[model samples]
Target: MTSNAENELLERYGWPIEEMDFGREDDPDVIGCAVLEEVEGGTSGIFVVRPGLDEENRTGFAEWAVQRVGRYFEHGPEPDGWQKRSDGGWQLWVRRVEMPPI
Candidate 1:
């Protein structure tokens, strides 16, 4: 299941639930959440510029996203940062982050 914070991240990016094949009426957290790709320890998701949105805005949203790995999260730009794949999807690096539990 996706936490509220995770769902908020997707909504901020204008994530296309339907186009991504995960309907809003369904459980969209597990499959579409900003989760760590177990094999590579990375994260991936699709972002759309909607009808009124511009490319710049979409790109900004992508960069703003953070990948959640259980209780940890990772985010950055280029070289060792998150970036949009050639296919227009965004993927985060496999840099595991650890923080003291609150």
Candidate 2:
């Protein structure tokens, strides 16, 4: 996708697009981060999108990510974590950070 298209999607979703070293030597596309504010007094989480995936997989990944993140905030517990699956999808994981006193 063109940079303009990427920018438009980011604008629509209110997600911040950032470039980071994704630890891949040949990957050219920059990774994006969609940060959601903390809810119910919980820590915020980052939703990562791998733009380097194939076009078909990118669309599927985007859809899967949206649903997964929505479920986390709406029904799941607070401070949930996630990672991209090796098979080209997302997987929600339990966060393991030290929390401040409540």
**Each candidate's TM vs. the true structure?**
0.26, 0.40
Count of steric clashes across candidates, in order: 0, 0
**Angstrom error at residue 16, model 1:** 7.2
Best by lDDT: 2
Which predicted model would earn the best TM-score?
2
Question: How many angstroms is residue 86 displaced in model 2 relative to the true structure, after the best TM-score fit?
Answer: 23
lDDT string, candidate 1, 1-27, tens digits: 343443665675434322133333343
Candidate 1: what lDDT? 0.37
Off by over 4 Å in 2: 1-13, 16-20, 24-45, 78-102
Query: Model-by-model lDDT, in order?
Result: 0.37, 0.47
What is the clash count of model 1?
0
